[model samples]
Target: MRGHRPALRTPRVRTRGAAIAAFVALAPLIPSAAAAVGAQEITVKLPYDCALPPGPQRVAVRVAATFPDRVAAGEAIRPTGVTTTVELPAGAVSDLTALKATTVVPETGLALDVAQRGAKAQALWRGTGPARPVAVPAEGSLTLRTTGDAPAVTAVVNGDLTLTATDLGVDLALGTADGAPATPASLSLTCTLAKDADGHGLLATVPVGPSATPAPSGSPSPSDSAAPGSGRPTAPASPTAPGTPKGPTTPATPTERAKGRTGHAPKVGDARAGSSADRPPAPPCVKKNPTDKSLNAYITGYANVRKLSGASLIPVSCVQIEQGDPEIAFPPDGSIHLLQKSDAYLDYQGRKQTPPFKSTFLTFGFAPTTATMVLEQAGPMTVASDVLLVFPDNIAETYVRAPLVLRVLDVEVNGTRLDVGPSCRTQTPLSSPEPDPATYPGPHLVMLGKGQLINGTDATGYVLTSGGPLTGEVTIPAFTGCGAGGEDLDRLLTASISGPGNYVKQIQGQTCAVGVEVPTEGQCTEDRQPYVVPKPER
Candidate 1:
């Protein structure tokens, strides 16, 4: 049997027949050249949403601007191309319906050209000359079908969009398709110097007209305020037409000048605080009804000062006092006192800390027991007082305690009992040595001086609306702080404190009978005058 098997053949496997394939020769690929030196691209996101009916829609026409990094003064910087893309929401398809679309080309340094895409060619250009509006054909109004899922449609503007780079930055408004003035957004192009990899900077310059003369060396150069050695490049002068008159420069206002005087406190009685006669008439005080009672008052503002020993600025936080308790009582004599039950908290680094931290019973106390209020007919009702900010422990722990004195002045209540403007003055008195054991029971007290302290002047603008809430801005000037050993600190801290926004106090109810007696009509009028009420007879 084995011998007979030798003649057995291997099994044959049948396979499906294959079809013949055709081939064509293709061209070789070509690589593009690298971009030019100093070229940069900036892409901005344009987000838009529109409500549309059940159909396709075009919501926005997208555009892009390409220009040089820097342009010479008085020279035009034209966009390389203005590509427009008609955009639609997601999940939308074009219906091939004829509609109309329009957009105004900006009048700037560049020109534009419109180029159609395919043979379907439903869109038609409908504009005559320069400065004319552009119109295109569409199936439906952009305002209608624009409500649903649609994709972006792209086309090229067939005209010039140009602007002269006369200033540092040029702003272009984005218009709507209907030729309506719609500024969905704006584009800003800034001309800035280009820096090389080696840290060298390059700037472009345009020649002044031939009539123009080089500015005198002693006189301030147009770029004087600019960084040294970073002046605009000089170029050959161009011919200037005759009859071009140079305009006179306008002078800066006092307010403008005051900005330069940062860190310096304004004089106590500056023009801002005009004399009573010169001030505008105060708003009429809506007389409170017989049952109306005095409302509780709270002080809300900001505290900004340097750290005990640092050049960097400290974080800005809010300063607030809870209201009620030793109700802000304005005695008949116009004396204000607050043995406040609510604690004053300083929001420091997001942590709520009481002043004179670590010391129990030691709190912010107004000395002299009361503050005098000066009611003004034409201006604010001024409340002035001395605040004692006790810093019981020195940073180095060498000194037992330090006290900083600040004078706070508030003015102007346009409505109800709101005071929106205030000025503060802070000064460091000579630091006193450790207190004698008998005089100072618990710990030794020392004074903190200039190079060894934290202090500054704050200009605050506060708004106290009716129903007991406050808000304001606190601007602190450059301030110095000292090191533990009384060494000069490095940097000065300056900051602006904004808000807790929700800073508020509950208004405690009271009958007209309690506390200060309601002022009579005559008394109210008298209080409006600048005179203070004499202390009541004992």
Candidate 2:
């Protein structure tokens, strides 16, 4: 009886009242006026402070993220794009920026944009390659920063490093703030905090047309030498120190010191003792500096001089001389073609071999003629003895013993001779068609051809520039003790430097393709004039 007392009379609800109740319940789901007040995503913080290193040192930056709000179940945190700005020091190049980053992140992707020197800045996405380049405004002392609050975002940026150009005396930084700003995320700003090395600005790297044919092997060369294979200019400081003297020294600026040399002669203190007395009298001429624009233009002229090829002792071709006092012609082809009316002495014959000379694998391929003694070698030969032969003033086949390694500079035939040392390699050209570009993508960048000799004895010739073309030839006469026919097995000098991007042709017979497998030559057969292709390790 007590429970039914309150609801004795039931009242009917009006339709208008029901409608109003529904409107009130759905109001929260609709956009509220205050909804815009709260932050929709995490905030990005930039480092406001910056520090510059004393001298030239390279600096790099990386930006990563940490989790706070969860975007999805499996994905917790990731990287947003990183933006770096560099400020050049006063009097230094303004607003120059470079970047170094990798696309390695979890659950999220990132992009990197750099602005330097008021030039067009580059944007590289983590997963993708370089994007369209953009231009940035000039800047003053400021901190460069990055933010990643895209629509599909979740976490906040953990931290970021400031990048400063070590090579330049500039500083870089990021901005740090406690609260967030609701501005557009486009980081299109520039800064000036570092200065490029004085006088040591980057030089231009242009590819010349083609290589000229090498001069004939064993022939007397005129006084003038030829240009390098890449047609890059040579550095004229004297062939080497003791051999000759340096040209007039103009005031050298600090920038010149930082540029360094391209395997040029060492500085005064670092010069080596004269290795061999038999070393030909130092060349009378000086090498032109490779960095000189005028000299480089002159050298590139040889690209169309002549084409070298074929198997003949005396190459029938010759390239015209461009400059120098006593104009001379050189063997346009790489091979030494000695065309004689009658047979002549082929091997060292009158010359005495040197010591450490236990046994040498003499590799020779001679086509005996009525007057020509043409013996061709795959590369240079390594003899174990130290025996020297002297041409007699009277009439004696005299001999002498000297240094172990012989730097065959000039080749003498009668009284005239040709330059055949390291310098000569550049002067000579390939008889074969410029190496197939398909085999080596950037043909001009191969610094070492098949028969380049480096550092006197080491067969490992180095690639001159990081990505420059091959310069000289590469040959290895001695591989430990594995003799011709693979006998007397010694240390193995594998072809690590010979690979794709370099030259390695495919021929049927035992051709000397960079990294090809071939049967060993018979005992007594050696690779004469062998060029050593240098690898990064050895």
Which candidate ranks first by TM-score, i.e. highest?
1
**Candidate 1 segments whose C-alpha is farther than 4 A from its true place:** 1-47, 50-61, 69-130, 136-538
lDDT of 1 by residue, 1-538 (tens): 0111211111110000000000000000122132223322322212223222342222443323344433322222323433323333332212111111133222111111111111011110111112333332243332111011111112111111121111111122233554444432222222221222111221112121122345666643332111111333232112212332111111122223222222111222212211211111121112222222222221111121111100111111122222223234456775443322222233233433211110000001100011111111111121111112223211111111212222223211111222222323222211223334454332111311111111332212111111111211122222233122443321211122111121111111010111224321111222222100111000
Error of 2 at 236 (Å): 20
Q: Candidate 2: worst 10 consecutive residues by lDDT? A: 293-302
User: How close to the true structure is residue 459 of candidate 1, measured as C-alpha lDDT?
Assistant: 16
Model 1 has an lDDT value of: 0.20
| Candidate achieving the largest lDDT | 1
Error of 1 at 30 (Å): 42
| Tens-digit lDDT track of model 2 for 1-538 | 0112222111111110011111110011112222111111212222221222232323232233322221211122222343323322421112122111111011112222211111111111211111221222243322223332321111111111111121111111111132211111111111122243221111111111112234487643211211211222322212232332222122111122213322221123322122111111111111122111110000000011001111111110101111112112235553222111111111222232211000000011111011111112212221111111111111111111111111222232222332222321111112222244463221122122121222222212211111112232222122222224433322221221111221212100111111112211110011111111111100
Candidate lDDT scores, in order, read 0.20, 0.18
